[model samples]
Structures are given as structure tokens and as C-alpha cells.
Target: MTSDTREPAAPTLQPRNTPARVSFWSAASGIGLIVAVVVTPMFWLPYGSHYTFALLMLGAVAVPAGHLGRRRGKRPDARDRGLALFGIVTGWLLILVSLLVFVVFTGTLAALGLLFGTLD
Candidate 1:
């Protein structure tokens, strides 16, 4: 048999079992929802009928982010699906509440205007 002169081939590296990562959007959505819930009440305290448009803005952002987070969380490498769902639910709730507040405020203003004969 001829003498083997070639060096042995190096062993291939194997992939390690790494832990899955949390989705950033998911975390952001959740945190934002929480903050909106906590801070929005403070606004209500100052004026029960004024300065609540911020809730609409926050809900608008959180809803989309939560949807994206939920999609990402579906992947095997990402996590926090529950938090994403929570964000989505709370965001929608906030939007509903904000809309109701706006409607009431506008109606009250219109009624006052009519009463004072300002809307002729």
C-alpha cells in the first residue's frame, strides 16, 4: 500500500444550543402599554375632559408594534408572545376609551356652544 502523506481533515464545528431571544418590538409594545395605562390616568386627574389625545397616539403605535411582535414571536428563535397579545388587547382598549372621551368632550362643547348661541 502507498504511504498516506495527506494530513487528516479537521472536524467540523457543531452549532451550540443557544437560548431563544426576546423580540424587541414585543417588549417595547408591552412596556408602552403599561406606561400608557399608568400615566394616562394622571392626565385624567388634571382635566377629566381635556388633554387625552395622547392615549390615541400611544394606542396607535402600540397596536402596530404589538402585531409585529406577535408575528416575530411565532418564530422558534423569538419569545414573548403573551406580552405581545397583552399589548394588542390593551392598545385597542385604550383606543376605544380615548375615542369615547373625545366624543363626549366634543358633544359637551357643542351643547355649550348651542346654549350660549355661539354656533349660529
Candidate 2:
């Protein structure tokens, strides 16, 4: 066969309107973090409990997502990478925000308690 000189085919671009699919569990876990951020302060959960919850959510959801992405993409696509990163950051930021909220809420409560001459 005569040698064929071809530069090889370039990858085709996806349509601009094609939306990237999000992994269901990955998103659910992220939402779980958001909930923890809100609920911890509202319910007056101890910081340790909030931290524990965040850890469980990460282990149960985010780690599995990374594994699934690795299986699906071999080298994960931007969408997969973004989902994985968001999952991680969601858990971390939730913990951080929860701690901040907890401190502020407790401080305010303490100050108010002192003002009333009784600790609640």
C-alpha cells in the first residue's frame, strides 16, 4: 500500500448549547454541605458534629465520585474535574462557614445572655 500522508483527524467540538452532565451523587453531596452550613447554626449543633457530618458526606459521596470519574474518563474531562473539585470544596467550605457561624451565633447569644443577667 502506498504511504498515506495525513495529519490525522482533529477532535470535533461539541455544540455550544450542549450542556455538560453533572454526576448526580456529586451534586447531592455538595447540596448536603450547603445544608450543613445552614442547619448547623440554626439547630445549634456542636462544631464536632458538623465536622463529623461533613467528613461522612465527603467519604460517602465525593470520594466515590472521584472513583467514578476516573473509571468513566480515564483522564477526567473538565466537567468531571470540576465536579470533583466542587465536591471537595463544598465540604471544606461548609466546615469553615459552619465554624464561623457557630462562633458569631454563640458570641451574640452570650452577649445577650449577659445583658439579661442570665445565661441561656
Candidate 3:
């Protein structure tokens, strides 16, 4: 009679040159996203509403920022990960709400219906 249980294999870490390591490109992307979201609307061309700029820019920012958040540092700490992710996600949520408000104010949703459909 023999025991069937086996020990789990330990996770092997890769060498320093691992391709997945944090990179300048990823960090630059993260910084760009955050900066554009926070800064661009102020300098944006005159528009009908703040929501227009927010709608256009914030969602664009959140996706890649959140992606790069994980690999922001070669050895990112919990705070780095948390701040990056929270900033991205929160910014996105705000943008979505702002877009809804924009659709209501600008009648954009109604306009789309008329583009290819006959309006009585």
C-alpha cells in the first residue's frame, strides 16, 4: 500500500532577461494615458460640452492604463498596482457616466437612428 498524494511543484521564476519584464514602452504608455486623461480636456479645442472631451479621452485612457498598470515597474509594489488600477478604472467609470449624460444632452443617440433610417 502506498500514499497517492504528491507535493505540488514549486513555481520556477524566470531569469532577469525574461521578455515579460517591465519595459520603457509599457511605462511610457501608462504615463501617457494618465496624463492625457487628466490634462487634455483643459487644452482641448473649444467644444459643445466638457462631456464631449471627457467622453472621447477618458475611455481611451483607461484601457491601456489598466493594462500597463500591472507591468508598470520591474518590481511593482502593491501601492503601485493599486493606484494605477484604481485610477484607470475610476476614470473609466466616470467617463461612461459622462457619456450617458452627453447622449441625453446632445441627442446623439436619436441622431444615429436617423442616419440610415427614414424619420417620419
Candidate 4:
């Protein structure tokens, strides 16, 4: 009996040339959900809320910055990947921060609603 000792073929890794598709609606809904969670605190604040401007600034700075700074992975004249990575990280950070802020905001509102009679 002849014994075959051939090594198994290695799997090929397909090159990822296509950039991730970011839709306007998905982004918008994400922003909106986060905002709904966070913005409720403004209504309960004694004075005009300081958090309003913070949310606005987040949107103003993060959304466009994120969109404008996505990675162009396949371009011949692509800029440093570090910058793109930074942008992606920063974008995610902003999204997470928004989510956290919204959570606190909504919780505070729910507490207030329970205290009052508006929760129904």
C-alpha cells in the first residue's frame, strides 16, 4: 500500500476591497434612538439644560466627521490608515457616548414620570 503524505491546501483569504455601506436612514435612526434616550432630561431640568448643546455639538462634530473620514481601503493614493482608524474609533466613541447619555436621560425621565402622573 502506497502512503500519501500531501499537506492539505490552505484556505485563501479574499481581499476586502469594498468599503462598508453606510446608509443615511440607518445612521439617522441610530442618532434618533440615542437622542430620544438622552434628551428627556432637558425637559426636567430646572433651568435651560446644559446638555442640549452637548448633544448638538456631538452631532455637529461626529456625524459629518465620521462620514467624511471613512476608510478608502483600495485607493492607490490612500492617505495614512492611522487617520482612518482614528476617525472610525472616534465615530464609535461618539455613538457609545450618545447611547450612554441617552440612557441616563431616559431613566431620569422615567423616574420623574413615575413620580408624576404622566407615565400612563
Give per-residue lDDT, candidate 1, residue 80. 66
TM-score attained by model 1: 0.58
Query: What's the ranking of the predictions by TM-score, best on top?
Result: 1, 4, 2, 3
Candidate 3 clashes between residue pairs 3 or more apart in a chain or in different chains:
none
Model 4 residue 47 CA deviation in Å: 9.1
Clashes of each: 0, 0, 0, 2
lDDT of 1 by residue, 5-119 (tens): 9998998654321211122343354456546557777655576543356666656766777777777767765666676676677677767877887898889889998988964
Candidate 2 RMSD to the correct structure: 9.2
Per-residue alpha-carbon lDDT of model 2 for 1-120, expressed as tens digits?
Answer: 898899989997632211112334544655666666567665535465555455455545554554455355433233355555555455455455556756877798899889898634
Per-candidate Cα lDDT values, in order, are 0.62, 0.52, 0.52, 0.50
Between 1 and 2, whose lDDT is larger? Answer: 1
Q: Mind giving the per-residue lDDT tens digits that candidate 3 earns over 1-120?
A: 898998999986533421212222333444564466467765433543653554546555654665565454346232245545555565565567567757776686577787757755
Candidate 3 off by > 4 Å: 1-48, 73-79, 108-120
* Cα shift from native, residue 36, model 4 (Å): 23
TM-score for candidate 2, residues paired by index: 0.40
lDDT of 4: 0.50
Model 2 shows how many backbone clashes? 0
Candidate number achieving the greatest TM-score relative to the actual structure: 1
**Candidate 3 lDDT trough over 10 residues, lowest sum:** 17-26
Model 2 clash pairs? none
- Per-prediction TM-score: 0.58, 0.40, 0.40, 0.40
Task: Look at candidate 4 and tell me the lDDT of residue 83.
Answer: 41
lDDT tens digits, residues 1-120, model 4? Answer: 999999999986654322222223233444664566557755535532344344445544544544544545435554434444444455465566656766788898889988887646
Using lDDT, give the best candidate's number: 1
